[model samples]
Target: MTAAPVRLTARALLLDMDGTLVNSDAVVERCFSRWAERNGLDPAEVLAVAHGRQGHATMALLLPDRPAELNLADNERILAEERADTEGVVPVPGAAAFLASLTGLPHALVTSADLPLARIRMTAAGLPMPSVLVTAESVGASKPDPEGFLKGAADLGFAPADCLAFEDSGAGIAAAKAAGVRVVGVGPRALPHHPDAHADTLTTVTVTAAPDGLLTVTVG
Candidate 1:
């Protein structure tokens, strides 16, 4: 017998870009690894603290002795590198279809990547550009701080509790949860974060507009 699907209704959908809506793992790792090598830091350790956080924050963590201005400049250079390298970038499974289904819905992209890098990656993945994009530059802090997600919810004119957040990283999940948003975790990386719902990929979930003006999300 088939098990019943889980359903939730939300006034808006908030999504993380890399590793959630798009797959840019290769480019991300490559750029970060190169940056680490250039800075005499361990690539593995750098990457461990990098994902889902702003570039400047990662740089600050990795090089605490450095001046904040230098970290900011390094972040800008890394963003350019990421923007220039999109060879293996692609949409997450069913991401394109899922986004297409949200035509009339309130949705936004909240990413740690700076604006230019986010644009490059999304364009490479062939994903539709979000009408509302809250990038790293738009917030005072990154994921795990809840600033971006909170800003995203506000930009969509939805209360934090009324939004549904989709994320694939622990930092992102923490951010959403802290902002009082229910989260649908996108992949294995999100497991430890204990999101409200879990899916192997976007393909396993479906969205529909309800009569009561809510977006109904169904997960299998």
Candidate 2:
């Protein structure tokens, strides 16, 4: 039997970039692999824990012995590489239309990417750049800390519980949940996080704004 659809209502929407709204998998993998090869680390292992976390944090995790300045420099190089290579960056399925439907709504883009890289990726994906963007530089701590999502909710002028988050990675899901927001996992990659609602793609979900100013989300 088919499970019944789920509905959630919130005052604001918090979204994650990268694997969530933007499809930059090619650029991400290539850069990480090249960086790993240059650093004498296993590329698979490096990527295994990299997604949904800030580049600097990923560097720190992969090379704990390295000085903080060195990690910072390497992370900058990675961001530069990503910004220069927009070969395959595009929106996730239904992301463009879904975002358009959110016009005039309270929403924010919360991402692990720093400002420049986030802007570049979003532009490449043809997404409408959000006015309120919570980047890596916006928080002292990244995902799994809930700082970014909390900031996003605050920027939207709503409490965490008044927001609904959408994410496509385990770390992003954890961050949203930790911030006290109900979250919809946006892709197969987010399934392991066991988000409140799971959709194979954004196309499987719909958003509607009510006269009462609440956003209604329906997921199949």
Candidate 3:
């Protein structure tokens, strides 16, 4: 059964990067594919475990037989290319309007992306730079561990239970729940995960825009 829609009364919103705020599938696939080919690894295998995971973690999983040094090096290389390559990236529909409506809302970005890739992907997606972002480098543990979401909540100066998380991946959903935050899953695949709320897209949700450009978004 699906959880109830998340209400927005907290001081913050922790949004995931890929699939949630933006769709960077092509770019992500290309980066991983290219890196895998260069390293004599299978592109499909690499990509199979890439989504919703940090670069370092992906490297460990994909190139497990490789030396730690090699994995570290390749992770860095992949990160660099991803940061420089943002083609075809764009914000998920209604993301901009949703962000615009919450003019004074205290929200933060929390993603598995590292600093550079986060900035690059977000910019390519045409999303404004959030005042605060919790990326891979900031957390000792990644998604599914709840560290990223919990850190994001802490950064926003709010209790985890008081915050709402927007996520697209199963791992991200697990992380949010582990952090004690309600979650809204975006897109179709996310629905089966039984998020607190589900939407076809950010566009499907309603947000009231005031004359001053402020927005009040209602969930569920």
Top candidate by lDDT: 1
Name the 10 consecutive residues with the lowest summed lDDT in model 1.
Answer: 1-10
Sort all candidates by lDDT, best to worst.
1, 2, 3
lDDT by residue (43-94, candidate 1, tens digit) is: 9998887878888888887788899999899888988888889999999999
lDDT of 2 by residue, 26-102 (tens): 98899999999999989999888788988888898878889999988988899889889999998999899889988
Estimate, for each residue in 74-105, the C-alpha lDDT of model 3 and write its tens digit. 77888888887888898999888877755567
Task: State the local distance difference test value for candidate 1.
Answer: 0.91
Q: TM-scores, in order shown? A: 0.94, 0.96, 0.84
For every model shown, the clashing-pair count is 0, 0, 1
Better structure of 1 and 3 per lDDT = 1
The per-residue C-alpha lDDT of model 3 at residue 98 equals 73
Give Cα distance to truth, residue 198, candidate 3, Å.
1.2
The candidate maximizing TM-score is: 2
Question: Against the unseen true structure, what C-alpha lDDT does each candidate score?
Answer: 0.91, 0.90, 0.80
Give candidate 3 misplaced runs (Cα > 4 Å): 1-11, 38-42, 63-66, 207-220
Model 2: residues with Cα > 4 Å off, grouped in runs:
none
The residue-level lDDT of candidate 2 at 177 comes to: 90
